[model samples]
Target: MIKTFVPAPFTTHPALEGGGILHGFFGRQGGISKGIYDNLNCGVGSDDLQAHVLHNRQVLTQTLVGADRPLITPYQIHSPKCLVVTGPWPNGESEQCDALATTTPDIVLAVGSADCGPVLFADADNRVVGAAHSGWKGAIGGVLESTIAQMEALGAKRDRISAVLGPTISQKSYEVGAEFRETFLQHDARNSVYFAEGAKEGHFQFGLPSYIVDRLNACGLAKAEWTGQCTYLEETAFFSYRRTTHRQEPDYGRQLAAISIT
Candidate 1:
């Protein structure tokens, strides 16, 4: 079985209902990449060999979705920009966006992540789906809201949309400097609620998923939940940017979170 970490509030698609599947694969246990990427490194941008990355992606797609289903992913520029996809985009044509949405069936919507959050959204009623790559910058810039708007544009009702934030760096492992905190507060003083004092004097712990959840709720989505798996703290199961930096490793792996209607 593919033991994915799924959020409790988001309902799984019933086999009989055929609503499609929303799921994510944690990085670490499988694949052919070596060195800093170790095993199961799916990130195309990483220093890992393209052949190895392609093989890893192929393995994941076969094991998770199916043999022939292509996983759709964007270039992920850490912007709030979103793309409305109708079908499989041409191979190697990267979009300069952080989010993607579609109302079509069978094509998998995918996003890559290491320390950042991979957010997946679905509306079974309208057959609309979306995926987003949310780093601190993208999250603060309203990537979540942009995704919601795109889904609504595809005829998805806000009240029927269900979203889940996959594994990411939690507050305990995400220590940031004073300037980082200020950048958020500059946008809204209420952003302080997502920050807590860290061990160091000038640093603070940032709650990434909490901010994501708050944004989803603020957008009036009927259901939003986090898988609550902290990437930095769980080295055996996840790849973390902070962890890689701490070890002085050249590059790190990335996990894929995906959802599709079929």
Candidate 2:
């Protein structure tokens, strides 16, 4: 039998509270991983031991749902692609997408992230839930909107969907170059409000969470909120890609944010 472990310092959102749904914004705590990966590292794509990664994921799913219910995650490639999940994929089979939505109860929709935002969505009225891995690329590419659309197709109303962003790199830790700023401005001049001068010249501090919340609200979600946690800034609570890159680490673990329709 696979050993069961529990996550520590898990987070939940008030907007998602009281629904017939169970969700968590899990941090990088509780598990058996070691070294740079530490414990509770859930990134299957990371360099952590494959067995350990599987065990960690198992712990997360079992804690939120049960040992019988499987947790499903996509082979995310920072795209806008979203899929409607009806049942568990065959072993070693995973979809190539960034977001997943389902009305099926007990099954968990999971998203993995380091510095990227993991947003959980639920329309309790219709028993539909979704999870998305939104980096700057996925955000700009419309992953959030795609997830909502998929949920709507699965009988969820845009006005009833509640979205909450989990731990992510806040603007203070997200610095970008001139080209990046130019791209957003090119997308929409209003996007400029999300950018501010960085400590270094020619660089801007990007507000990814704010931008994501704006997108969610504009997409007609009934409620939206950022947990106000920064992956890079909160070393104890999250794993940060930018921090790892800054420290020039060989690899970094990924945290999980998941939701299930009860």
Backbone clashes in each candidate structure, one number apiece?
0, 0
lDDT of 2 by residue, 1-262 (tens): 2554454558998888766899999988877889999888999899999999888888887777666478889998999999999778877588999999998887888999999999999898888899999999999999999999899899999999999999999999899999999999999999999999999999999999999999998987899999999999999778889999999999999999988887
136-217 in candidate 1: lDDT tens per residue? Answer: 9999998999999999999999998888888889999999999999999999999999999999999999999999988988
In order of appearance, the predictions have TM-scores of 0.91, 0.96
lDDT, residue 219, candidate 2: 89
Give me the runs in candidate 2 sitting further than 4 Å from their true place: 1-7, 66-68
lDDT of each: 0.81, 0.90
Model 1 regions lying over 4 Å from their true place: 1-18
Q: Weakest 10 consecutive residues, lDDT, candidate 2?
A: 1-10
